[model samples]
Target: MMRWLSFLQLCLSLLLILPLPLEAFEPLTMGAIGLGAVGFGTYFKEYTYCKFTECCDDRSIPANIEALRSSLNRYLFGQHIVAQHIIPALSAHFQSRSTSRKPLVISFHGQPGTGKNFVADQIAKALYLKGSESSFVSKYLGQADFPQAGMVDAYKARISREVRNKLHECPRSLFIFDEVDKMPSGVFDTLTSLVDYNAFADGTDNTKAVFIFLSNTAGTHIADHLGNLMKGGKLREDTRLSDYESLLKRAAYNLDGGMKKTTMIESHVIDHYIPFLPLEKSHVLSCLQEEFWRWDRNPDSQKNKKLIDDIIDTSISYDRTHGLFAISGCKTLEKKVAVAVNYS
Candidate 1:
């Protein structure tokens, strides 16, 4: 009678511990119940815990992708090219069943305040429940992490190990490297194998990971190209990816910075070179309106317009030749808006 009670207690414990629904468990024969319970408990406790977590599931991909698209369109100003190109690429990579030949590698190049970092954050928020704070998301700032050029070798090994460990733990990881232009040239070489096609490291398949590289390296080229296009009587809306992608790649490869002469560029490991174009005056206005909304202020009110006009007139600088593009982009607008809100 005591043995039967012990078996029932063990069965109840298993029902509580296992991730499966209660209905999945059935009456176990008392003959070998004790031994089976012990083995099952050990395996489920260790394996099922991780497998059932949010990290291991791709069921949220479609909903997350839709959320990402909505966020980008609603929040990100200017850079229609970025919004148009990135969505399709991301959808293809995440939704497909067959393993990708390589991880999705996107290098965002543009001037300051053109929404590179903002877009990256939105992508993270859309994909993970905790967004940028998710354990699976890793962000590295080039200047802060690899400040000294002399420590390139040590930085390489550390970053390589970190990437391997993260991918080993969760294959669907996102790595955002900001200020890549400030990182030492050789540091990216260490990441070559991790980003390449059919690559595996530390016994983990790296093809499921996503890497986003953000830099101000090609901002000038992007701005200049846009200026030239406008000068030739082309509307900014009509500008296409072809107009700036090759220029960005060449600038990234030949320019002096983290990406200069990096193997990633030379071998074409970077799948997309998305250019964040210089913000026009209208885009800056939209940004100011959004900032106003954040503060619960009426963006279209005369008082707000007066403040926004002052900001546009005094704080933001436009292209010297055409006065069409915002020189500093929307980078400085947030502070200006905050100051205006405080004073008014």
Candidate 2:
């Protein structure tokens, strides 16, 4: 039996390597070859190569917008505009069976700790089974990746090559550029072509990929816009993307950052400018409650309220106007919670 199996395996290897037409083989030989190929090919492709390649599947693409929506709604705190605009845009983008004219480029503009990076991670998680850790996902930090101001030309070439290579490897790749405000000017000029409508120009169809730029460039504009709306007695939920989209674009374009004077923005390669509003005091409290629950420190209502208040007064800083909004959002809440839990 072992001898027969080895003979069959050898025959299969030869058949695969030679690529002989099926018509060249006799009917019985073809049948045996087909059986052997199916058995061994299935084993190698499914169990062996999958472990190394992180084989692509339905999860490799953005298929379930509703799942993403649910995740953003549940875990992402106090960014209604983000969910409202982003979900619909993503839904439309993924729903279209036709090839895209351009890559999906979204610029997340907001203050730090206002869920910019968090939302990017959520999008990655929804698209790939491994989420942000997926091989297809590439995250770049501006200051970290391109620190030297004199290395603009070098950075541009390197970033373009990296992006092209990644897209070549996985066309459905997700590229997140964090702290984009810190990157050197013209660094992204190399990427304008990759994110543009052109397809297969350099043997890579980039239209299926997604590029996300997270910046604090227009954070002040976003917060001020929201503040103005609030001052006029307008609810944050009532404000639309239109209210802040133009403001953010203008700020990003005018601001002295990586995005300034870039063709990607001027030519409108960026499809959406999603604004993350500053977190209000109520949002901070929600974050605190969530953190406490995460730590399994479910104190009584009074004790929990006291702890939250103490944390807010001691650690959290509020805006000067009405003391309604948190300056740092929930970025520091987890650490503060840990300390509070340890002490109390």
The worst-scoring run of ten residues by lDDT in candidate 2 lies at 55-64
What is candidate 2's TM-score against the reference? 0.86
> Which regions of candidate 2 are displaced past 4 Å?
1-48, 51-53, 59-62
Q: Lowest summed-lDDT stretch of 10 residues in model 1?
A: 54-63
TM-score of each: 0.86, 0.86
What's the lDDT for residue 51 in model 1? Answer: 49
Off-target runs (Cα >4 Å) in candidate 1 are 1-10, 13-54, 58-63, 199-202
lDDT of 1: 0.85
Task: Give the per-residue lDDT digits (tens) of candidate 1, residues 1-344.
Answer: 67457656777976775667655555564435556867766645544554455544553222288899998889898878999999998888887526687788999999899999999999998888778887889999988998999998998898889998998887888999999988888888889888887545337878788899999998888888899998899988899999998899899998877898989988889999999999988999999999999999998999999999999888888877667788889898888899999998
CA lDDT of each prediction against the hidden true structure = 0.85, 0.84
